[model samples]
Target: MAGRQGGHHIACTGLSAFPLTPMRDDAVDERAFAAQVARVAASGVDSIGALGSTGVYPYLSRAERARVARVTVEHADGVPVIVGVGSLRTSHVLEHVDDAVEAGAAAVLLPAMSYHPLTDDDVIGLVETVAAHSPAPVIVYDNPGTTHITFTQELYARVARVPGVVSIKIPGVPTEPAAAREHVATIRGAVSEDVTIGVSGDPFATAGLAAGCDAWYSVIAGTVPEVAVRLARPALAGNAAEADAENARLAPLWQLFTEMGGSIRVIAAIAELLGIAEQPCLPLPIRGLDGEQRRRVAAVLETLDHAAEPDRDE
Candidate 1:
């Protein structure tokens, strides 16, 4: 797996936080979104991902998405901002990339979006074309859960060879600590050593880092960045025992994410509970957490926040 190497590395290793796109009355809440970005940056996350899956990229119009990207970069406060540029069409994806670049984003994340299942060659062509067109570095997002297209190790190796492709964000968590380690090692061996491998699905972050993945592309961090930093710091520092302990503390929140269907609902509820934004998601049929669900989520968030607080005596 070899190709020309000219992609600019955006220093996105470690805990890369994905911030949710706060909405107000079916419109992108620019002020709330900027506050969210600032909050994550203040929490010491390595990078900020705007318009990620949790950001509801597909649900928003191009102009709205571009505005989010611009606000994210502006509020990131020198922290690198990675903009998601995934669209069903290659041409549209390229347009998004240009918008991200023009908006001063540091990097771009591209997922293979398809209404029909894509072949290996089709996926490869998509990445190559995007990488060739993107002025900034491209992070290949392999989220089979949403896109229904998985990037195997072989495909990753091929995509890694594309010029300007600097990283890959893989989804799902490994079954165990050992499996997580093995998974990272296998992917690292398959691609160029210079290529960073980041794992999404926040619950798997500790294990992914313990296994040696370079970064954690987190959903939970979109709202609760402090918890994410606590988990990431230990894992990145090679403190497996501490990382595992942190992960244990996060178990309740992770459970809520699983029970609530996904992070979007739970995070929207958390954002509202924290008074950061109002409860608004992608329109009907894809609503935010209901009243009962909000109460339950608020309870969990309260408990977690209390547990994370430092002792007053100290």
Candidate 2:
């Protein structure tokens, strides 16, 4: 769990916002991206993860991804930044790790990217190699949805043995809330206590935290850090009532995300709706919501904003 260069150890707990990388003219829009990062940093998130799936890391070129990481660190304004360094090739992942370390990232989120199904040994090797080379601590990102490589409790235990592998981001268990809780417990039991277990996929966050997850690697936090924090604080403190109440309020937003494919597309539309950025997303096959879709998102945002405002005593 020690950081490189005597830096602070990566604290993989609380809300870590995975902000979108704004794009313009088919390239990263530096100005817009900075603004978004600054906004999230100021919103009281525990950390910022740049170039994640939500950040369209796979879509951007290595140079662009590196630039985004540096920019994220700069705009994080003292908040820890965890840069995603997942790539198809282990060597390419190392290059990303170097970039993140050079940019002073607090940690690197490493996902085993593979076209062919990866064996448990393949995942272990990938993580060991990346952690060996990375100056920053490596967070094994177990996102089966995108990477198609799921990390079992046994695999997590093996990866935790790798030096500098400090945390794991478990993809949220979408169904059977009890199963999600059990899944978190299983991972928690299997891995060393030092290897923090965080949950991704915002809808499952409340249950995940209730189930003993250490942190929430959230897409919703990227757009609405205040809301995410409100929900997380209560949940993490074992206040299930308050946490569930807050989560219930966000059900509509989560429903929208599910209806519109997924968080990547919906979140990009959300950023645009909030004026945090203009059409921040990857190009076609992964485009943002259209005008009509945006209006629906705007409506939900307005409702959420109103509900979040403190009531005035007459």
Candidate 3:
């Protein structure tokens, strides 16, 4: 947090777009994956988050993830790339971090991915070990929904003290503006000022940023970057009202996320409808939104397309 890590500040602030790792025929679709990286890079996002939860990091093999990190750096057009390195085992996580850094990743997103419950010491040890071994900076990822490990403020303070730790990606902020601001402030106070706090939970990206979180670690941005960027620009500019307006504009998109149960399927559905990926792009047994669900997703996309608005960039 004292800036000792010295990597790009994208880990701390700005919009880091998480692009999907598309699959086809039960294989990692390198072509589709490359295209996704290139598309996110083209959008002028602050950074490219490769192999994130949105990118299905835990679903792929180490070799596949290494290849993905390479593809992401190659297609990122010089945009910094943060690779996810989370696994059930510490040994595997270390291996993934090495592979990611060797593949030219700018930073590594480390989460305590566990099949068994993890103690605070276990998670802390994981962070310390990675920070010690990997040259790439570490972004602590706190995703209780998927990883089943919630981070306490005390944990944040402890991890932020690790030499190479640069960012902490927290879950959604409170819906109420005052509460959201307080939530972000408490975390900010826990860590050194150099450590950036990023907000995940796509629906609350705007509020998180507006409340003073420096970065938006976004999932939906992986599919529709322009919309996410539109919201971020204003929020980062300190124009909270404008950012909220933009978020309000994507009400249908957010509704779809809640209705479809989660972001992955809905995003995969959007990717297919946009022709960025083929149907069944997700890994096996996880068949993406199908038939009627897909139709509903399509209608949402169509509405978004029909009502598209211009951002300042335009």
Highest TM-score: give the candidate number.
3
lDDT: the better of candidates 1 and 3: 3
**Candidate 3 per-residue lDDT over residues 146-230, each given as its tens digit:** 9999899999999999988989999999978999999999999999888889999889888898889999999977878887888
Give the per-residue lDDT digits (tens) of candidate 1, residues 89-117.
99999989988988888889899988999
Best by lDDT: 3
lDDT of each: 0.82, 0.82, 0.85
Regions more than 4 Å wrong, model 3: 1-11, 305-314
Q: What is the model-wide C-alpha lDDT for candidate 1? A: 0.82
lDDT of 2: 0.82
Q: Considering TM-score, where higher is better, how would the candidates rank from best to worst?
A: 3, 1, 2
* lDDT over C-alpha atoms for residue 40 of model 2: 83
